[model samples]
Target: MDHDAISIDGGTAADRHARPGAAGAGGANDLLAHFSDPHSVARYAEGPPRFVPGFTDLHRMTRLLLTERAPDDARVLVLGAGGGLELKAFAEAEPHWTFDGVDPAAEMLGLAGRTLGPLAARVRLHQGYIDDAPEGPFDAATCLLTLHFLAPDERRRTAAEIRRRLKPGAPFVAAHSSFPQDDGERALWLSRYAAFAVASGADPDQARTARAAIDTRLNLLSPAHDEAILRDAGFSNVSLFYAAFTWRGWVAYA
Candidate 1:
């Protein structure tokens, strides 16, 4: 059997090909470490259900994207593509759509490589920032669960780069961490997210630490801020399709 092909039963294609005692093989710690490296697969798995309240946001976003535009044979760009979940889902839906997946984190890219399996070859992986991605006037693009990690300037720069790579009138989907403009609304949302994180199997202390890190480092913007940044980056008709707590998904045209 091809090790690159995922099994319908369980385990990744890489898992099936694993030899005994392979380096970084076996146990939940090793798996967790891999999933939580520079980027995080674990957060994606838990964030929507626990912090955001809607468990099906990603699925709904992808479905809406496909429904709006089939992406058949389209050259799609996946910015900050973690663990390849978006790539796998999109590819499965539109078999002819080719993807350029870019991420700065090595471990995340490795996870994506495994997750993609045989479909790996269909996606050209760039282990760097979006600007470093190969030439592309892509047909469409998706930047999911990213963006808010960057500061205001970097976010603007990245969005500009995305626009530069896409053809005129091309569609782009972006989902990011956000907060309500009102102070009370923001406080309430953050409190709920913290509580939800603890309830969703995260250690309370660790969750608090994570939240602090986000508060200090990540530039979680408001909905208006995001729209302004995108519009300045040359996108038009920025419309929200999904909104759950701090997570918001929008579709824009280049």
Candidate 2:
């Protein structure tokens, strides 16, 4: 199956706000609207769920942690857990681990609960941004795809928060869609895609504007920068475990 084309089972608020013309009157409002959209659930329910190859790396990372018996008794935090598909997988794979999923989108959380049903009971769902996440010292944490929505500073702050919430030697995995390292390639693709988006009837200007907005709102940390952020956050051992085109994944020990 085409995993990349397979959408998550639920839609978070961010999906709606990002839709053309549905954006709210202001920046914060637009952000909030997109973050709260409930369509993510519908998308997931429409078909069988499967992890993208990149996400499989996340599962592998978790498995490695389990093999090493990294704080299995500690509470797990899934930042931007979306519809809880990963939570379901983790819960099933390691029932000994309890989970607390935090996402700013209510619709996404609701979908997560519905998708997992009784299994979902093991998770404590929180509706809030990763930056504003409640108290932690979690045994481990995972943030996927969602990081692409923040700017540099926000990404740093969020990483710092994740670090603070982790127990010593705890594992933290953060993934994002990276910009191409080669300046020429990056510029060429952006120029080509910008034209393609416009040719496809999307407002080229709006699309460009939205791209900037996303860059400002999300932190699509480059592989090198991502490692640096983790190391700076006090994570001792950090390395990139996976990459697929723009998407990259990291595994770190706090």
Candidate 3:
């Protein structure tokens, strides 16, 4: 995805892969390729609200947690920032806050711009992975519904990079597909994930298909390992704050 003059440095695929845990493969990984489609980008806004439990409350919770450490004039770094749902929510909540949003998919970032509308003025969109983001001592950071796409090693490396960009004691919130990896439990959680989607008004087959995709594609880990990833990345005071059918959220400090 190419960036215009106003956009941040969105490096090439090789540049993205130059470092461990680097995302934004210009050549297109499966997830990135999926979002690259105009159809997917157009429908992006619909998926999260319907698939993820308590989507609105999740954004509200993220804002509250960030506000605990971030100042009124906080400069936040948001990874997986495509579509701008969370960014819009945060901007609405804290009018003074400015943002640097990173995403691998240019189409989704464009959608984010459209979604933010006038609020887009406060956000600088970067169409690349974490590596494309500015070297910042940011006030806070967030990566939600995105990390599941990476392997454990990559996730740890990415979290470490996020921590490295934070000010001392800055809050970092991450939420994604996390559940038990135990044999029986893993299958159980996945079924529940699909069931919940259906209950939330999704087509039963569509929900089941989505669940199967997650089961095959996402690198899910047990909650213990998820917390350990934060700790291993040098975050302190890690605490789990949200847990839905197949999702988990944690707030940690750098």
Candidate 4:
């Protein structure tokens, strides 16, 4: 669907603040800790529907991004590694590469560790914000479905930090959910998300509250804004690589 072409304006800050209901809130310590139990991996692997198709596209994009590089050991950093789906795939595909998964959610990290097992030895998990993460000069960096959670200023700072840690000409791919301009359309989608959250077993009230909290902190950016931020961070050859509905993806050379 050429998802990268969809550009959203306004609501960047608000979008960061709005939580995608309860499922979104699961990233926080309390909820994520419960969700990340090792035994829960079996249940989660039962093929639940993803909120967007871009979930699978990430592997393709990662391969594309790495295609030009020579077959050498590379250091990769994944910010907000979530459940480690992308990191796992990347690690399997590029055995020569070492990956570090960074996320503030200990539960998510634990789940990823258990899932990766042997491969987990090749991945170092860090719990903290991107800025606070340990020093790095990685060959590449990725932030799948995570950047939207940052405020505008934080986004810029993150871009700069990522760039600082990446080798020259390395790529940084970031994706985040955005809002539509049409108020009715936005409301309708929000309603659908609310229903989806409830169906996923999240508490309705908690879901709504979390969504509101995330909405209050979201800082969505238009394509222009995104490009500008990357450029300001010393990135070149910035390009939007994928998109679907509210999900916008970009790749920038550091």
TM per candidate comes to: 0.78, 0.71, 0.92, 0.71
Q: Pick the candidate with the highest TM-score.
A: 3
Candidate 3 accuracy as TM-score: 0.92
| Candidate 3 lDDT by residue in tens digits, 1-254 | 23242354475544544544444232225565788788989888878877899999999999999999899999999999989899999998899999999987777887888888888889999978777788898999999999887777878988999999999999999999999999899999999988888888888988988888777766778999999999999999999999998999999999
Q: Which residue pairs in candidate 1 collide?
A: none
lDDT of each: 0.69, 0.63, 0.86, 0.63
The better candidate by lDDT, 1 or 4, is: 1
lDDT of 1 at 214: 55
Tell how far residue 216 is off in model 4, in angstroms. Answer: 4.9
Local accuracy of candidate 1 as per-residue lDDT tens digits, 1-254: 12234222123435422423221123312433344454465355554455555545575665467446534678988887757778887777777888888765555666677777778767877755665576798888888877876666667888889989988888888987787858688767666677777887777986686666555555667989998999998899988888876678888988
Better of 3 and 4 by lDDT: 3
Q: List the candidate numbers ranked by TM-score, top first.
A: 3, 1, 4, 2
**Candidate closest to the true structure, highest lDDT:** 3
Model 4 scores a C-alpha lDDT of 0.63
TM-score of structure candidate 4 = 0.71
Question: Candidate 4 residues 138-232, lDDT tens each?
Answer: 88888876766565566788889888988888888877765553657655555665566666666688558645643444555555676687789
- lDDT at position 22, candidate 1: 22
